[model samples]
Target: MSPERGRPPRRAVVRAARRGLGYMPGTLLIAAVAGVLGLSLGAGGVPDVVPAGGGLTVNDVTSKAFGQHAPGLPIGELRHFTIGNRLFNTNWVIAPASVRSLDGLGPYFNRVSCSACHVRDGRGRPPAGPEAPMMSMLVRLSVPGPDGTPAAHPIYGEQLSDRAVEGLAPEGRAAMTWEPLAPFVYADGSVVPLRRPRLDFVDMADGPLGPGAMTSARVANAVFGLGLLEAVSEAHVVARADPDDANGDGVSGRVNRVWDHDAQALALGRFGWKANQPTLRQQAAAAMAGDVGVTSEHFAGGNYTAAQTDAAALPNGADDEGVELSRKQLNRLTFYLQTLAVPARRDTHNPVVQRGEQLFGAAGCNACHTPVMQTGATAAHGVLVDQTFAPYTDLLLHDMGPGLADGRPDGLASGREWRTPALWGLGLQKRVSGHTFLLHDGRARNAQEAVLWHGGEARGARDRFARWPAEDRAALLAFLDSL
Candidate 1:
């Protein structure tokens, strides 16, 4: 698969120009002139930014946009991708059943399948009200360990599983109620409503969670273009680390070193809310074990804690190799994630969007949301290797201040720290997921609110954005919408 396989064709650009040449920026006009003269725009600093995912990009602006396979997937790997898609959407049942392949659901789990949380392979949101259950979200549980690191709650383990298989009691039900904060008034007198989530546990099957147990509520993140992210070199990630702010940029991003289960050693953290998981494969295995209660090669045992004897003693759906999901199945699932396409950016030539892009860079948002990163030569797939993709994240941990802090440490990430999420799909979230809820906890209602919630290292950028003219703010949002 060539790196240019899915780029927007010349005709697509012509169509965009024809829609309204009046709305085109001068830079875009220059590009049009360059195109007519058979001149390349690369030398003039006019970026060819339409293909957001490099060769893996797909042009689709509909609800099904996030679920596409990466452009130019090999015929041989297509079978594995199809099988992985099935496994992701398949709902496992209770153990010792006829369909052994789809068994071993849970003694305790949050959702039955990966698609249950990440519906359509897009983002998940919190429940609309307290009357609703957490359909596409979950709550993590832990307490202070002897060395002050986070340890699993003696009974609840690492995650709170709200659902269980037949004849077994679930850990508990996770609920949330929103507390409306004072509306943020911008310099231009525009106000954006803000709300914070208040997580509560009810219907505890065992006993009360003792005092000082920490909990974090998280919505399921979109899973597309992960293969490209996984292919980004550790050296590239480490080169961006500025843990001490030695350059005085006020943006001190630090790598979160975590245990790589496959390597059995500490490695550069890349995926997850806290950048806690080292690889996409490990992240998939962990989700299967923690969210679906399905054991994989990485997590061969059930998710039950020693204290949960009833859950542990129950008949599991382990196969001949003593694991619910075999190595081949896990590999297929990982490959599926590795090949999911990233939607191409929209409205790249729109004048407002161009201004917003400029404003985004001017406000230093790019400091954390680095627009482009080159993948290493080696990847799970040939298409993902040596590609320049725009994921818009540093994948480093930064202190987000007290307002957004869960007060729950994850690996080397402190309670105030959170991994910077990619901004590539920010524009199409509403079309794909039906909701605009964002952030690790889904407290922010939209991108603007999400920006307002930023603190700590990002406070400078947030403050700059807060002080922008309303039109500039709108343009910035427009640019994000075009992403």
Candidate 2:
């Protein structure tokens, strides 16, 4: 049974109220008790808190929280998961290095390893300033092309690699200048500042980017619970698409149909900010080629474009198996990503969190950040199949308005469209990644800012959120924090 259906227990309510009003004096506690008894404690009364990931949720809520494997993964597979973990954290060096298994860092690439961007399997943050090196983020580049596909930059290709091997000139350095917009005032008289990012390229090996080049700034997202998401039936995801807002909810979510190299056919995209990759394995392969300049079966050659003559001359790792990463190695990395567990929600029973939960639905945040979903039987792993989870995302693309648009179309996703990111381990980002940046490009500094930046399909929810009273806002935030 769903926890929200029943009346909350008295002890749970009192505990939640105590936690919610922890800063308040003793008198406030008396008042809170009275309020609870009067049935006016929360927005619509105390709500029941469900387990965020149902059976798959882990209990840890610390710096290492995002690194756990899903509970009950078979012991035999656990060994494979460990092998995959090593591959995930392995730092690749330049070709002809002492470490043959980890060689082939880059002829031209952004980082040397997967962990460089997705630090600790958590989210990546934007650079602190224009002078700061991009440690955990990257810039995607493209130009207008024939058909639906966005064309890769002729010189820089699809991504700009700011770093390269010993002899090659890096593509260019990427920096950002932020232009602050006027502050927006909420109905409750709170002011929130917003900023837009403008990307700049300097020291280009191929001179300036094409005049028509379109760019998108992307931050690495948390890598947990992806297996469960991948496990969701394609039919289930497609069924959620309401591209025309047929229900009149003012929210239209659609799926991105992308090419699956493995299948050699068009398939539903389930990963990336624009939902551009159809499978986790494919996503890993693309990252290997694009970010680390390490080739896999999917991308057998180096990441160099034909124009990157200097980069093409660099030595690359090759074996009878085909590319830099063996199929075994790629399988291990995919397994690692697939088994990383979702952290269990914290403070779900807190009165403020409970109230916020009610307000979250009331404000229509649940429209795209759908709270519950059931995994189907098609999961690659038995552990991920037939599980009901609370990932808090519909995993469909929604038009996020001009404020968040990258002005770069990806697959079926428009410039203004972004896939609804899962919010399961959101509150733990600061602990895991050492920062609180949110959203695709890491522009929003916190959850509040993230919500404030929402527009287009989410404008209604954002407006409703702004209209909420201070206490209600606190409750809503508390609820999000608990998640």
- Best by TM-score, which number? 1
Q: Tell me the lDDT of model 2 at 22.
A: 52
How high a TM-score does candidate 2 get?
A: 0.90
Q: How many angstroms is residue 132 displaced in model 2 relative to the true structure, after the best TM-score fit? A: 1.0
For residues 1-483, write the lDDT of model 1, one tens digit per residue.
Answer: 011113344565344334434445656655653353233467555545636788999999999888999878889888989999999999988888899988988878889999999999999999877778999998889999999899999989999998888788888887799999999998778788999988778999888888989999899999998889899999999999999999999999999999998999999999889998999899999999999999988898899998988988899999998999888889989999999999999888776666567667767898888888789889878999998878889899999899999999999999999999999888889999988889998998888899999999999999998987665676678778888
RMSD list, candidates in order: 6.4, 6.9
* lDDT comparing candidate 1 with the true structure: 0.85
Tens digits of per-residue lDDT for model 2 on 1-483?
A: 011223356675565455545545544543543342222344443423445665678999889888888889899989989998888888888877787777888898888888889888998889877888788888889998977579888888998899998878898988877778888787767777777677888889889996889999899988988988999899999898999999998999999999999899999998999999999999999999999989889998788899888878878876667688999999988988888888888877565566676567667888898787888967888888888778888899999999999999999999999999988887787788988788888888778788889999999999998876666666677677777
How much lDDT does each candidate structure score? 0.85, 0.82
Which candidate leads the pack in lDDT? 1
Off by over 4 Å in 1: 1-45
**Clashes (N, CA, C under 3 Å) per candidate:** 0, 0
